[model samples]
Target: MKKYCFGVDVGGTTVKVGLFTVEGQLLDKWEIITRTENNGENILFDICESLEAKLDEKSIDLDEVKGIGIGLPGPVLDDGTVLQCVNLGWGKFNVSEKMSEMFHGIEVKAGNDANVAALGEAWKGGGKNFDDIVMVTLGTGVGGGVILEGKILTGHNGAAGEIGHMHVEDGEELNCNCGGCGCLEQYASATGVVRLANRYIAKNSESTKMTEFGEDITAKDVFDLAKEGDKGAVAVVEQMSTYLGKAMASIATVVNPQAFIIGGGVSKAGQYLIDAIADVYVKYAFPACREAKIALAELGNDAGIYGAAALIV
Candidate 1:
């Protein structure tokens, strides 16, 4: 009989699940809408239903499954408790325990989504060659995961890699959802990029091509405009890149990881964003830490799914 494991990545909009062989090949995959309206119970129900369907379709017996791993967008307690996912409307839920009960005798494991992404990158993406790496996801919000000596470092409170919450500017006063001000995430994420662009448009409307797109625009629009030599768009990209580089330099000074693996939607900006950030990172980074490499994520959207599978192995 063949052996397999189930890996699930839970996001606000969708839950992606994959079945993988022990050797890391993804045999099959599926996705379902993540319904957070029912306090996450609905999401769990959706996962169970989808997995059963996939098993039936593949003619796979439950007995051949080794275990189930999940990546959640919240801090998972040491004993598998999910503590308040702001995006999912779940708080203090025994995620692993509940899933184990739902799956009968199968083992269930869970971790923070960012940590899982890091593990995924280490297992199959850009950081595969390096045992020590920091994975940063640049999306609506900044998320991060740290790997040291081939192990995920969750710190004492399971917030070890919450580098996004680190303060970037003292007394500068940028509001953050975490109730803090001047967090790195506030200035280095896609949302941040949009905010900066909007501010630039408000102050210097004449310099932007964004005015042509009307009142509402996005970070991608800014990048597109910059590609067309829009002055305001170029300025926004430069500012965003500088802040991101400064944040990375701070991370390097402390963690000194072998590589900083950049992932998420914003990373799609590719070499343009990479080169811009690198210019500032090398300037501010400690001499020893400046040697660390900055690389684009290779796995794209499938990273979380593959990383969840890695946890079970």
Candidate 2:
């Protein structure tokens, strides 16, 4: 009987790999630099090589491994076909098919990185107590994933949780990376916080601590200043929280998840951030969904690997 499995989280700069027992206990983990040269053609081969090396080091036979699960930084169809991963310089292709071939028919599963992370959180992280949840990642961009009854809700064409692109503003002058204006990501992401802070600083004539950093301000700086009672910083946080809370309330009317799991870099602001969003969420949420709990993600960076492993577990 198979006793082990592997998980891989592919990113632009590196690949995170983990070895886990079939029961979902992680045994070891490591990382490898991502060589994106040649349109990332070597990426898969490199991951395979790393996996093989890991097996050898652990003295485990190929027959003892059940399968491998992978998470990629782009939309992935239910059938494991990656529509297109621009950051990886990859075009449409079957990730499961190619990896299975390389492993001589071993089972392989693939999913969008954000979705997989949500699955991981449901399985063992912040949302472990609930079977239904929405995970929002607030990093360079805002990403989201939904889980229902412990399974990922991969929508048609595998784009169910692109929450960042939800139109949140009426007249945004700047465009989001997705090419839309006034997206939730534009005001809720870490970069988005900086943008808001800058705009607030530009218009407010009041003295504040944010100006101490001048042009080198950051999301953390804004949150820190807010915690320290800086009016300008507090205003920026309030604006960001308003957009996020409103978007989440709209989502609740549709999915009505048991909980909303907040993750990614900006979430590091901790309970203050959660409280801010939760306060706004209740104002707009449907009466039936008003009790949905908002909580912080527990897995941190390791969430991706854990989620990938869950694909096969």
Q: By summed lDDT, which 10 consecutive residues of candidate 2 come out lowest?
A: 204-213
Instruction: Kindly provide the TM-score of model 1 when superposed on the true structure, using C-alpha atoms.
Output: 0.93
Q: Cα deviation in Å at residue 237, candidate 2? A: 0.7
Give the least accurate 10-residue stretch of model 1, judged by summed lDDT: 166-175
List, residue by residue over 193-228, the lDDT tens digit for candidate 1.
788887888899987788777667877888888878
List TM-score per model, in order: 0.93, 0.98
Where does model 1 exceed 4 Å of error?
Answer: 170-174
Instruction: Output the lDDT of residue 310, model 1.
Output: 82
User: Taking the tens digit of each residue's C-alpha lDDT, what string does model 2 give over 148-191?
Assistant: 99888889989999999999998899988889999999999999
lDDT scores for all predictions?
0.85, 0.94
